[model samples]
Target: MTPQQFLQQKLQSRQYAGSYRKLQVQNNLIDFCSNDYLGFARSLELSEMINAELQNYPTILNGSTGSRLLAGNTIYAEDLEKLIAGFHDAQACLLFNSGYDANLGLLSSLPQRGDTVIHDELAHASIIDGIRLSHAKRHSFLHNNLHNLEQKLKAAHGNCYVVVESVYSMDGDFAPLTAIAQLVKQYNAVLIVDEAHALGVFNKGLVNQLQLQSAVFARIITFGKALGCHGAVVVGSNDLRQYLINFARSFIYTTAAPIHQLASIKMGYHLLAQSQLIIDELQIKIELYKSLMGDVPQSSKSSGAVQTLIIGGNQPTKHLASNLQQAGFDVRPILSPTVAEGTERLRICLHAHNSTEEITQLTNVIKINLHVK
Candidate 1:
């Protein structure tokens, strides 16, 4: 077949499976779809703080003209890393353009050919992609199955590495971190936790909240979710930072984030440090949502910002999401292939800015639409 025909075949296959993806513009509706768990993305106060922080770096360039190994490194950037490292209680911090890059760079570069990389099956696509790039032997345990994880750990060879997310994105469930840490320690394997969904939602992150910082080998924290900014950081030991600086293709090859982005990160942390009341407000909304959901059939048990309602088919899941959209709630479907075929769902994200009335309305709409008791 011709190249066009090959591309068409793949596109057709996606369509046949009801998973054809499309780009969408944000609509003016109540948000139950975004990753802005703390609503920092839309916070006027945060925008003002970012603008003020930018003013402090007047002489800094608008763009990082080159990669950090070249001309992009700045005292401001280093200082920001230092600040982040200190906040997370890590020995060092290395910044990446995004969580994907951080995961890719770290996972791809660290494990050698003879080493093993084991991750939770429900770990993000970025984690999977990163492992694919590595030359290491790789395996995935069933999601949060400690026995399966232990089996994998037992069979692992040559500098085993265990990876999991502090808060899983799709299901919004937490990893068995403390137990996993103990298991990894028992097996003498390194542990890496992605705190992408847990960072701003749990203050420093679930790792820090649980005081497991020392137990982890590295923690990947992103600014886009709860922080409502951009970029990511790999918080680890000083040696790991230096090793990645020398070897991580993603970090060494890509241009560093601009001064404005770093300033935004700085101010984001500043706001997050003082956002306990805001965080509590988010928890209140979550509890309110859960209470309203009230054993609704198909609802996933989640305490985090992300909640899922399994609809079981792509068409039905999409239909429910569309109905929610029509009701002025921006709830989105997690379709087949993104999730398993029979487990398609509506992923609802709660935010501090979301009101009790909104949560009540949303739950009521879901219940009425599902015809639940």
Candidate 2:
């Protein structure tokens, strides 16, 4: 059968249930939906800066024509890597097309067959997919449960890698970094932290701020979320960087990200360094989201830049989202099988550009609609 026919047959139940997702192109809504955490994507200040940087190379190629191993390698890409490495205090850095590819490449290639990878159960899908692609014996600990993570660690004796996100994407929560670092240290295991949601936010992630670089084997910091650009970087030792350059198939096989995209990433990095306004705005919005969510049953569970309300069912979650949208809030439903069946939620993303008024109004809309639904 054709792809369309196959999808129609296999996924029709989802479509009929109001859970099938097609891209909804709407603008001008009070956005609590996108991962543009710091609102740099819509920042004209950064846009003008990027345009100015382009002036230095007027004929800068539009796209990177090939993979980094081939003709895609460029001076600016290497420069960006150095800047990233220095910013995060890593010995080196390697760029990937996106956070997903970076995780896939790192997890699939880095861990040896005899190694073990213990990860958090609630990790993002990219991390889970990457671990599946790995050859290591894998185990999962309960979300944010240090004791559970330690129990798994104590039972393992191998070249282990503890995988976690600095800031979890869905729940907007932070990893127990200090405790995890201590456990990994006791086990003599390498720690891999995906700082995808923390980059250009959280003072450049817990790894950088808490001085966990010496304890961490690698960090995956992506530009998509807070930097509001595209692409990701794996930051670690020069050897790890070189190894990925040689063995990471995602980097090896794919066309390199375009020069303009790299330029944008570079520009985004510098903009993050120069400005604290976006960071401040986001903190304000986060506070607003928290304040608005007051007296809600699970309000204390909020973390990172995402505020998730676990509504427990796909149909109701989608209904609540639709209601919020109708009420002028652009919130999205996180449904199964994206999350497990009962953990379905409204994934509200707070942004630097989101005003206190917008946050308060939207969250109130969410509470009213979700409670009713």
Candidate 3:
């Protein structure tokens, strides 16, 4: 068969299964979907701050002209890494254009041919892709299950690496970090926590929140989520940073992020450091959502910004998401392949900017529609 015929067949299969994906532009509606949990993406004040800060570095170009190893390296970029390291209280930091690159670079390079990578089954796609690129033996433990993790750790060969997300993106639940850390310590495994979803939610992150920074071997933090910006950073020891710089293909080949993006990240950190009230506001919204949801059969309880209502089929979940959107709430569905087949859900994200009325209305709409279903 020709390539077009083969591609069409696969696309047809996805469409028939109700799992076909598409790009969409969001309409102006009550945002019940988006990773801007702190509402930083929409902050006019932050934009102003970033613009003001850019004046300090007048010569910085609009784009990073080359990779960091070549022409992309700047005094500002190096200083920004240092600032990020200090914030996370890590010995060193290395920037990546995005969280995907950071994970891909770190995982694909760190574990040698004889090493092992054991990750949680629910870990993000970036983690899986990074592991796939590596030459190491890989295993997946049951999601958040300590017993299963210990079993994998015991069976691990070579240098063992344990990976998990601090706050799972889809479920919005936290990993059993302290327990997992202790187990990793007992088994002499290196712990790598991706703090992509946990950064602004838990202040710095769950690892830093729990004071387990010392226990973790490395951390991947992203700015696109709650920080309302772009790019990511890997926080670890000076040695690990140096090793990635020398050996990671992703880091070596990619163009560096523009100076403006770095400036936005720097200002985001500045705002986050002083925005405890804003953080508290987000918590209040979460609490309000949970209280209103109140053990609804469809709703899955989550303390963080991400919450879900299982619809059990891709078509049904998508239908419900459409209904919510029609009612002026911008909620979206988690389809079969993105989640489990029987657990297709509407993933609702609550932001700090979301008013109490919006949360109430959104929950009421969900409950009413669920009852109708």
lDDT of each residue in 211-296, candidate 1, tens digit only: 99999999999999999999999999999999999999999999999998998899999999999999999999998998888769
TM-score (all chains, Cα) for each model: 0.99, 0.95, 0.99
Worst 10 residues of 2 by lDDT: 364-373
For candidate 2, what is the TM-score?
0.95
Candidate 3 runs further than 4 Å off: none
Q: Candidate 3, residues 167-261: lDDT per residue as tens digits? A: 99988888999999999999999999999989998899999999999999999999999999999999999999999999989999999898999
Maximum-lDDT candidate: 1
Candidate 2 per-residue C-alpha lDDT over 1-373 given as tens digits, one digit per residue, 9 for 90 to 100: 9999998886898887556877878677788888888888988988998888888998877788889888899998898899989988889999999999999999999887888989999898888888889788889999999999989998875688999998888788899898899988988988999998888668578798898889999999998888989999899999999999999988899999988888788889898997687787778778877876876875545646888888888888888888888888888888988888788888888888877778777867766765632
Model 1 CA RMSD to the hidden true structure, in angstroms: 0.7
Error of 1 at 181 (Å): 0.4
Ranking by TM-score: 1, 3, 2
Models sorted by lDDT, best on top: 1, 3, 2
